[model samples]
Structure formats: structure tokens, C-alpha cells
Target: MIRHILLIKFLATADTAQIKHLQTLFEAMPQKVTGVLTVEWGVNNSPEYRNKGYTHSVLMTFADEAGRQNYLPHPEHLALKQVLRPLLDDIIVFDFQL
Candidate 1:
């Protein structure tokens, strides 16, 4: 299995509604793409305040490396990126085997 993580920093102009819309889009991925086992989203709520401006996170679990690779170029993912790009100041993607 693979654990895929995304740390997101949205632009100041991005509103709550837009953020929620993005979350909705992300939540739909498992149903739209094969081998996507699960998708989880969350907002930063740490008391330590060490998020470095990243306010949201998306965590995806894939069945295998092929699943992760497949997700990279999937049409649904491309569409999601189109919706996400304009709202972001920056993003960090990290993955690890599990």
C-alpha cells in the first residue's frame, strides 16, 4: 500500500465556500478512480502552530504503487487539479510505502 499526503496552502482570496468545494471534489476521487482505497481531508488545528502556512491536508491510501502511479495522470485527477490550482498559494506532496 501507499500513503499519499498533500499539504495545501490556499491563496488569501480563496473563500470558505471554495475550500469546501475543493474538499468535495477530493472526496469524490475514490469513486472516480480505480485502486484508490480511501481519501481523507482535514484542516490544521494544532495548538503548536507549526503548519508553516499550510491550512489543509488531503491523505489518500492506494492499494499499491501502481495505484498511486495510475492516480497521477488519471483524467479525474487532472480535472481536480484544474479546480485546485487557482485557489492555492502552494502545495506539498509526499508519499511513502506502507
Candidate 2:
């Protein structure tokens, strides 16, 4: 299995509704893409406050490396990026085999 994680920081102008919409889109990925095992979304909630302004995260599980690669250029992912790009102040992606 592969673990794919995204850390996101929203632009100051990004609104709650837009953020929620993006979350909705992300949560729908397992249903839309092949080889996607699961998708999870979350907000920063630590009292430690070490987040460096990153406010949200997406954790995804893929069946394998090929699945992860396939997800990168999938049309649904591209569409998600279209919605996500404008709202972002910064983004970080991390992936590893599990």
C-alpha cells in the first residue's frame, strides 16, 4: 500500500464555503478513481501550534505505487487541482510506501 499525504494552507481570501467544497471534492476521490483505497481529510487542531500556518490535510491510501502514479494525472485529480489551486497559499505533498 501507499500513503499519500497533502498539507494545505489556504489563501487569506479563501472562504469557508470554498474550503468545504474542496473537502467534499477530496472525500469523493475513492469513488472516482481506480486503485484508491481510502481518503481522509482533516483540519489542524493541535494546541502545540507547530503547523507553520498549514491548516488542513488530506490522507489517502492507494493499492500500490502504480496506483499512486495513476492518481497524479487522473482527470478527477486535475479537476480537483483546478478548484484547489486558487485557494491555496501553499501546499505540501508527501508519499511513502506502507
Candidate 3:
């Protein structure tokens, strides 16, 4: 399995509503894509740090690389990104072979 992790830092315009919408979009992927085993998204609830205002994240799990490859350009994902990119300040993506 592969775990595709995306850590996101939001811009000022990205508010609670945007995060909720993004989470909703991501939650749909597991059923929509063939190899997706799990899909999750959320805001940071950790109280340990100052947060640096870095707020949102998505963790996508797949059976393998091919499953991940298909997910990258999935139309629903693309459409969500159209809303995502403009509101995000920074994004870091990591793929772990598990």
C-alpha cells in the first residue's frame, strides 16, 4: 500500500467553510477511485504548538502506485483543486510506500 500525504498551509481567504468543502470533496474519493483504500482530511486540533497558522491536511491511502497515478488527475480532484490552489498558501506532498 501507499500513503499519499498532503500537508497544507492556508492563505487568509481559506476559511472554515473552505476546509469543510475540501474535506467533503476528499471524502468522496475512496469510493470514486478504484484503488483507493482510504481517504481522510481535516484541520489541526493539536494544542501543543503555535500552529504557525498551518491548518489543513489530507491523507490518501491506495493499494499501490497505479492507484495513486489514477487519482492525481481524477476529474473530481481536479475540480476541487481549482478551488484549493487559489486559497492555499503552501502545500507539501509526501508519498510513503507502506
Candidate 4:
């Protein structure tokens, strides 16, 4: 199995509505594309100081490395990244085969 995890940090002025929309779009990707075992997304609502800067995370599970590769360039995935790129300060992607 393969896991694709994305951690994103946004500038405070970033469009919250658009962020939510992108989260929803990404969460639905497993249903739209092949080889996805599971997908999840969440916003940082914790009032804790730990993630004082970073705001959101997306965790995706794939059947294998090939599944993750397939997911990467999928049209919908690209579209979501386009929607998010402008608002984000930084994005970190981690993939591991388990």
C-alpha cells in the first residue's frame, strides 16, 4: 500500500471558502480516480498553539506506488492544486509505500 500525505500552510489572508472547496474536492478524489484505497482531509480548528502556522492536512491511501503516481496527475487532482496554489504559503507532500 502507499500513502500520500500532504500538509499545507496558508497565509492568514488566504481565502477560507476556497480552501474548504479544495478540501472537499480532494476528499472526493478516491471515488473519482482508480487505485485509491481511502482519502481524508481536515482543517486545523484546534485553538492549540502547536499548529499556530500550518492549517490543513490531507491523507490519502493508495494501493501502491503506481496508484499514487496515477493520482498525482489526475485531472481533478491537478485542478484542485490549481485552486489551492495561489492561496498557499507552502505545501509539503510525502509519499511512502507500506
What lDDT would each prediction earn against the true structure?
0.95, 0.96, 0.85, 0.84
Candidate 4: pairs in clash: none
**Residues 1-98, candidate 1, lDDT per residue (tens digit)?**
99999999999999999999999999999999998999999999999999999999999999998898899999999999999999999999999999
Candidate 1: which pairs clash? none
Of 3 and 4, the candidate ranking higher by TM-score:
3
> lDDT (0-100) at residue 62 of candidate 3?
94
CA lDDT of 27 in candidate 2? 93
> In candidate 3, what are the lDDT values of residues 30-85, reduced to their tens digit?
88887888988877899897667677778999999999888888887788889888
Better candidate number, 1 or 3, judged by TM-score: 1
Model 2 C-alpha lDDT versus the unseen true structure: 0.96
As a whole number from 0 to 100, the lDDT of residue 79 in candidate 1 is: 93
TM-score of predicted structure 2: 0.97
| Model 4: number of backbone collisions | 0
TM-score of each: 0.97, 0.97, 0.88, 0.86
Error of 2 at 37 (Å): 0.8
Candidate 4 error regions (>4 Å): 45-48
Better of 1 and 3 by lDDT: 1
Q: Give the Cα-based TM-score of candidate 3 against the true structure.
A: 0.88
Candidate 2 lDDT tens digits, 1-98:
99999999999999999999999999999999998899999999999999999999999999998888889999999999999999999999999998
- Poorly placed runs, candidate 2 (over 4 Å): none
- Residues 1-98, candidate 4: write the lDDT tens digits: 98888889987778768878887888788889888889888877887778747778988999987777898889987888788888889888898878
